[model samples]
Target: MADLITAGRAMSRRHLLAVGGALPLLGACARAGLGGGFPAQTVRVSAPFAMPDIAVPDFRGARPFPITTYGASPDDQARTSAAIRMAIAAAHDAGGGMVVVPQGVWPTGPIHLASNVNLHLERGATLLFSDDPHDYLPAVQTSWEGIECFNYSPLVYAFGCDNVAITGPGALVSKLDGWKPWYARPKPHMDALIALYTMARQGVPVAERQMAVGQNNLRPHFIQFNRCTRVLVEDVTIHGSPFWTLHPLLCRDVVIRRIKVRAHGHNNDGVDPEMSQNVLIEDCEFDQGDDAISVKSGRDMDAWRLATPARNIVVRNCRILNGHQLMAVGSELSGGIENVFVDNCHFIGDGKGADGWAVPIDNLLFVKTNERRGGHVRNIHMTNVTATRLRGSVLAVETDVLYQWRTLLPTYVRRLTPIDGLHVANVRVAEAKSVCTIRGEREQPVRNVSLRNVTVEQLSGPAITTDNVEGFRRDG
Candidate 1:
C-alpha cells in the first residue's frame, strides 16, 4: 500500500526564483567556466559574488612579510603551524587581520583556525602536510561520513569561530608516499590505538561524545569547521586527503566556492555539510572516492539527541568527474533534513569503476532513515542535473533493515522511524542498469514521494518499487 500526501511546506518563492535564475548561467559556463581558463586574480579583487570568485583579503594596510625566507623541512611543519597560530593570535590580540602563507613549500601537521583570521596562501605557496600518521594523532571530535566519531584532526580545523576564511590561490598537498597507503595505518599500533579509542568512546555517555574534543580515531578530513558562523573557503586545491575532505558541520552562513578536490583514498568524500543552515556550495570540482556532495546528520541515538535539521542549504554549478555518488543524503539522517536544493550539476560516472563496486550507486538524491533514527526529509528540489552515465538507479529511497540491524541495533535502536515527504523533479539520466527503487519498512511506509519531468533512457527493473509506501506520485 502506497500513500501520497501534500503534507508539508512547499518550496518558497525566493528559492524557486534563485534556482530558475542560476540554471541558465550554469549551462553557459558548463565546460569553459571561470577559473578553467581565466588568469589569476587577487582573492579580494576577484568576483566574490561570482561563481568562481577567489576571495583574497584586502590587507592593504597591514605590514607584509615574505614567506620565501622561511626554510622548508619536515620539522618545519610544527613550526609553520605554530607560527600561523601565533600570527592569528597576535592579529586577534590587536584587533584583526590576515595570516598569510606566502609562496614556498611549507610542511605542516594539524593547523587550527581562529576567529577573524584569514589563512591565505599565495600563488606559489604549497601547504604540504606530513604523511606521518602520528602527526595527526590524539584524535579529536569530528565527523567521518557524517557520523560523529573521534577521528584525526583535519589538515585545517576550526570550531565555534566567527568570520573565518581559508582563502588563496595556492595548492595544499598531502605528502602520501606510494608505499604506504593513505587510508591504512603504517603500523599495527595505530590500528590498535584506533580500536582502543573506539572502545573507550563506547563506554562514554552519548552526550559526552558529542561534546568531546580531539580526533575520534576515525578517518581524517582535509578541512573541517564545526559550530561556526560566517565562514568562507575559496579558490584552493586540496589533494590526497587521507579521508573525507572539506566538511562544515552545524554552521550558518557558510560558503565554499571555487575549490578543487582530488582524492582517491578510501572514503575520501569531496564535501560533506551536516546539520548546517544557509550554506552555499558552488563552482567546485571533485574527483573523489565517495559522494561528491553528501549531506548528513547525527548517527544512531546521537542523531536523536542532536535533533537539528540541515536546512536552507544550496549546491550549484559543480562538476563531478568520478565519485561513488554525485550527491547523497543520509545513511545517517537521525536529525531531520529539509529545504535542500541542488541544481546545474554534472555527474560523469566512472562506468568501469561504477560497475565494479558491490553496492549500487544509490541515487543522486538519496534519503534513507534507519530504524534507530528515523526523521523527515522534505522539500528537496533538483533541477537541470545531467548524468552522462550511471550504473545504478536514477533515484533510490530505501530503509535497509539489515544495515540498520548491523549498524544501529548494537548501539541503540528505536522503532517507528518514518522517512516521509520527498519530492524530486527535473532529473535526467543518459543511461543506467537498474530501476529506481523506492522502498520503506513494512510497518513504517515511505510516504509522499513525487517525481516530475524525470527521463531515463534505460532501466533494468521497475521504474519504482516499494515494500510499503503510502501516497507515492509520479508525473511525466
Candidate 2:
C-alpha cells in the first residue's frame, strides 16, 4: 500500500493500510454467515486453538541501495547477480536498507538475501532467473520434499536472517530451459532421493548430505526463507518456478500477502510453509501445478530429529485459480501440524489460462498422511470457502497418500499419524464428486470431525463417507 516501503521511516501495519491507495482487483474477502475475517491490518484468526498476533517486519530508517550503482545492467547476468549480492551485503552492513531493482528486465542467477534487507522491485521490473542449474551450484542448505540436504540454492534464499522482505509490484520469472529435463523421475533421480532419505534417516550431518553432484535432479525452490525471523513477502508476482514457489522453513512470525503465483511446473506448489510458526498468508492468487497452499512440518526421521511442529498458521482471503487442492496439510508431516485455520477463500472454476489450456482444481481441504508419516494433525478449521466445481470431494482425508515412496522403500518404522479435531463450516460447492470423504486408519482413527452448514449443489456420490472415523457429526 505505502509503496511497500516508505521513504523516511518504517511504518506499522496500521500505517501501511491507512495510507493505502486502491487495492488490487482480486476478489474481496468472503463475508458469509460466520465468516468474513481478513488479514489486512492484523492477523485475526477465529479458531479452536490459541493464535498469537503475528508481527509484520518493519524496516525502520532503511536507506536505499540501488544495484545500478554497483555496475548492474539489464543484459549481464553475472554482473547483475553480483551487484544484487553486493547491494544486499552493503545494506545489511549499513544496518538496514532497500536494495532496489529499478524498472528493467534484469537477468540474474541465485539471489542470497541478508539481514534487514528489503529486496524491492519497482513496478516495471522483472528479475528473470537463469535456467541453468549450474548457476545455482556450490550447494547451499535446502530441502527436497521434506528432507534437508545441501542442494542447488533457491532463486531467492535467506538463512537465519531477521527482518527480511521481498516486495513491490514486479515479477520474478524463471527461465525453465534447464529444469524441464530434470522433471522426469528417472532411475538416477529415484536413486538420489533414496540416498538422501537414507542419509537423513541415519542422522548424517546436514553439511555433508550434498546432492548437487551428478544426475541427482533435486529441483531447488524459487524463494526460500530458511530459519529466519520476522519475514515478509508482499505484492510480487512469481512465474515458472523450478519447485515449490515460496517456502518458509523453520521460520517465525512470517507474513506473505498480496503475492501472485502462476507456476505450472512439476511439483510447483504455491507456498509450502514447513515447520514454521505464526504464519499468515492472505490476499494472494495462486494458479499452481500442485496444491495452492500446502502446510507441512517435516518428514520421517528428519522431522523427528528436528522435533518442531508447524503450528498457528492462518490463510485468508486468497484465490485459487487451479490446483490439486485448494489447501493440503501434509503427507510429509512427520513432526505434526496443528492450529491451522483457513477462512474466506474462494476457488475459481476450470478455465483457460494465459496459455489457453484448461486448468482444474480437485479438492477443497485435503489432509493427507501415511503410515510412515508419524505425526499429529489437530484443531483444523475451514470456513466460508466457496468453489464452483471440484473434481474430487469437498473435504478429503486419506491415511494412505504416499505417492511414490510406498513401493520404492519399506517402512523403517511403523507409525501412524493421528488426526483429530477437524471442523468445516459455511462451505458451499456448486459441483463435486462427493461432499466429504474420510479414510482413516484402523489403528489410529481420525477423531472429532464436524461439518456445519456445508452444502454441495450437484454431487455424484454420498453426502458423507467415512472409514475408521470417530466422533463424526453433521449439523444444519
Candidate 3:
C-alpha cells in the first residue's frame, strides 16, 4: 500500500510538471504562423496551431495588476465578497492585470468579472465558493434543460465583453449545499421552488423571480459568458458545479482548450454552447453527470427571435470519462443548428461496481428535435470516435412531439419534425448492449442521414434502426 501511494504521488507530481511545461509551449504556438495553405484570415486556436519551438506566453505579462488581497475567513461571506470585488476593481484600474487567486482556501460569494480581466490561479490555488444559499442572490438569465429562463447567477459571469479570458492551472469548485436531498428542506420551500420553476416554464421573464441571488431556488452554473466575443478559456480544472460547467451563449470567436470539467449533479453538462458561432473546443476532458457536450439554440419564440444557429463549430481531440450522453444536440433547437464537426474523441464509460459485473453507460451520440416549435439541423459530421462500453444505443435520434402528450395534438404542430443532412463516419464501439435507434415523425422524417465505416463489436438488437426516415443509407 505504501508503494502504491508513493507511485500515485509521483505520478501526480509528474503530471503537474508536464502540464506546467506545456503552458509555455502552448503560448508560443498560439503566436506561431500556420503555413499549410490554411486560410490566413481564419483564426486557429487549437494546440496544433501553436508553434513548435516557441515558449508559451507568460499569462502574467498580459495582466496589469497583482492579487494582493485574500478573501477573509472561509466562512466570512461579506469579507470574501468585498475582497474579490476589490481585486477586480484593482485589476480594472490597472488597465488589465490578472486577478490572481493565490494558493489558499478562500471561500467567497459570486465573483463578477470585468472587461480586459483575466482570472488566473497558480498551482495549489483553490477558489471554493460558499454553499450558503444567501451568498448567491437574485435570479439571472440562464437555461435549464435547454430552455431559456431566469435562473441563478453563474459562479463566474461576463456579459457582452471583448478579449476576456479565464485561464489557469487551478481548480474552481462549487459547493452546492445538498440541494440534491429535497426531503431535507421544508415542504413549503419545495413547493415555492416548484412554483418558481413552473413560472419560468410558462415563459415568465426571469426578472419576475423574486428569489435572492445564488439561492437554493435556482441553481447556478460554473462559468457563463453571454454575448461576448474573442473569449478564451484554457488549462483549468473545474468541479462540483451546481449546473453546467462551461456555458457560452450567443458568443463568437470563442476557444476552450485543455480544460478539465467534472461534476456530478442533475443537468451538470461538461460544456454547452448555445446560440454561439465560430467556436473551437479541443483537448478537453469531461466527466460529468449529464451530457459531455451539448449543442443548443433558443427555445420557442424567443429562440426564433434569436434566430442565430450555432454554426462553424469544431470539437476535436477530447475525452469523455463518464456522462449520461457523450455528445448531444438539442430538443430546444428553436434557433436551428448547423455546420458542426466532432472528431477524434474517446468515450470511456463507467464500469459496473460490485456485483462482479458492469452495467453499460448511455449512448455515445444523441440528436433530437422538438415538435411544437419546428427547427432545422443540418451539416453535422462525426469522425474517428471510439466508445469503450456503451449500455444504450450507439446513436439515438428522437423528434419531439408537438404537444406534451404522447398522443398527437389537435394541430399538425405536434407532428414529427424533420432533421436534415447528418453524417457519421469512422465510429467504433467496442461493446454495446443495444442496437442504435432513430425515430422521426411521420410527416417530416429524418432526411439524408448517412453512416459510413461504422462498426460495433457486440449488438443486442439491429445495428441501425430508423422510423419514418426519408433518405437513410449505410455505406459498409
Candidate 4:
C-alpha cells in the first residue's frame, strides 16, 4: 500500500520564496559541464520563502586515482570491490581527488565512500553490485522507513563525509537475484518491522537496534548519503535497487542532477530527502515502483529528538516516466517539512518506458500523515508542471494514512499533523480520476491552499473535494 496527502487554497504570506531555476554553487559533472574538474555554477528557481544557495565542494585540479591501478579486474567482484576501497583511500589521503572507475563491467560488493572523494565512473562503465546479502554484512548506521537502526549497509554508502560525489556517465546496477525475495512481506518480515518500530518508540539505543540478524527482511537502500554535507550525484544511470533508490539522510547542501533511474523493486522511490536541508534535484528522469520524489523529515519520537526539519528543497526540470506519485510529502514527517518548491517538471511516455516498464502514478502531489505524526507541512509550491495521465487525483491531502501499521501497533503519540500553505500554478494535466481531495482532520484542518491557472482535462470526479479545510481558492 502507498501513502500520500494534498494542499488547500491561498498560500500563507510566510510561504513566499522561489520561482525560476537558478542556484548558486559549484556543481557536479553535468551541471558544471565538468569532464574532470569542478567549476562554479548557478541555477535559479522561484518559490515562496527564501531559498538558500547550496554550496558544492571544489574538486578542481584534483588528481585522479583509477581503480584499475589498484587491481580492478572485469567481472571479479572481490578484486573490483577491493580496488575501489583502495582507490578511495588513496584519493582521500591525497587531500581530495577523483577515484575513477574506468570503462568496464566491474562487478563489486558494497562500496563505502570516504571524505573528499569523487567516485567517478567513466563512460561505458558499470558497477554491477553483488547479489549476495552477506557482501553487505556488519550492519551500518542506517534507517528503514524513517526509523533509525543499525541495518545492512546500502550498496553505495557514505557516512559523515564532506565534499563527496558520485558522478559520471556510467551506471550503478543492482543484482536482485537475492534481494527480490525479500520484497515479500512475510510473517518474519512484518515481525521484524514491528519489533524495530516498538524498539524505536521505547527509545532503544540505535546501536542495540541491530536488524541485519536472522529472519529480518528489511532491505537495504541502493545509495545513501548519510549525515554528509556538500554532496552531489550527477549524470549516472541507476538500474534496480533493493529498497529506496537514492536517500540523502540528514545531509545539507545536496545537489542531484542530470541522472536517470529505473528501479522497479519494492519501495524503490527515486529520491528520498529525509531531515535534509538546502537540496536541489534537477534535470533528472525517474521510473520507479513508488513515489518518484518523496520528501520526509524523519518519523515520530525518533525524529523529534533530532529536531531538524527537511526544508528549502527545490526540484526543477525533471521528467517522470512512471511513478506512484510525482512527489510525496511524508507519512513519516514527525520532524516537519517546509519551503519545498517544484517547477518546470512533466510526466512523459504514457507511464511506460521504452523498455516496457510501467508504474501508474496516483497524484502530482500527495501530502500524507496520520494522527500519530505531529509534524507541520508548510510553504510547498509546484509551478509549470504538465502531466498526461493520473490514476487518482491531481492533488491529495490525507490525514489518516497508516497503511499496514494501523493494526501493527497503537499510536504512541496522538498528535495530529498541521498542514498549511500549499500553492500550485500553471499546472496542466491531460486526464485524471479527480482533481483534488483534501481530507483534513476536524480538530486541525489544513489551510491556505491556492491554485492559479491549474487546468485538467477529462476529470472523472469532482474538481475539488474538501473535508475540514480552510481558505481554499482556485483562480484561472
TM-score of each: 0.76, 0.90, 0.79, 0.91
Worst 10 residues of 3 by lDDT: 48-57
TM-score of 1: 0.76
Cα lDDT tens digits for candidate 1, 304-400? 6677887767788998877767777777676777777788888765554434632224467766666656666766667767776676666777676
Count of backbone clashes, every candidate in sequence: 22, 0, 20, 34
lDDT of model 2, residue 90 = 83
1-476 per-residue lDDT for model 4 (tens digits):
00100010011111122201111111221132222243434444455789887877766667999999999999688999889988887876666789998898999998888767888989999999987888887567799998998778799988777778999999999999799989889877777778777777777667667677666878999999988878989999999999999999999889999999999889999999999999999999998889999999887888998889999999999999889999899988999999999999998858666677788889999999999999899989999999999888778999999999998878878999899998989999999988788999999999999989989888988889989999999898
Worst lDDT 10-window in candidate 1: 1-10
User: Cα lDDT of all candidates, in order?
Assistant: 0.63, 0.84, 0.66, 0.84
Cα RMSD of predicted structure 1: 13.2
Indicate the residue-level lDDT of 373 in model 2.
Answer: 88
Cα RMSD for candidates in order: 13.2, 11.8, 12.7, 10.1
Candidate 1, residue 470: how far the Cα is off, in Å: 2.2
Maximum-TM-score candidate: 4
Q: What ranking emerges by TM-score with the best candidate at the front?
A: 4, 2, 3, 1
lDDT of 3 by residue, 152-214 (tens): 567887766555678889888888764455224454444444444344434555444333322
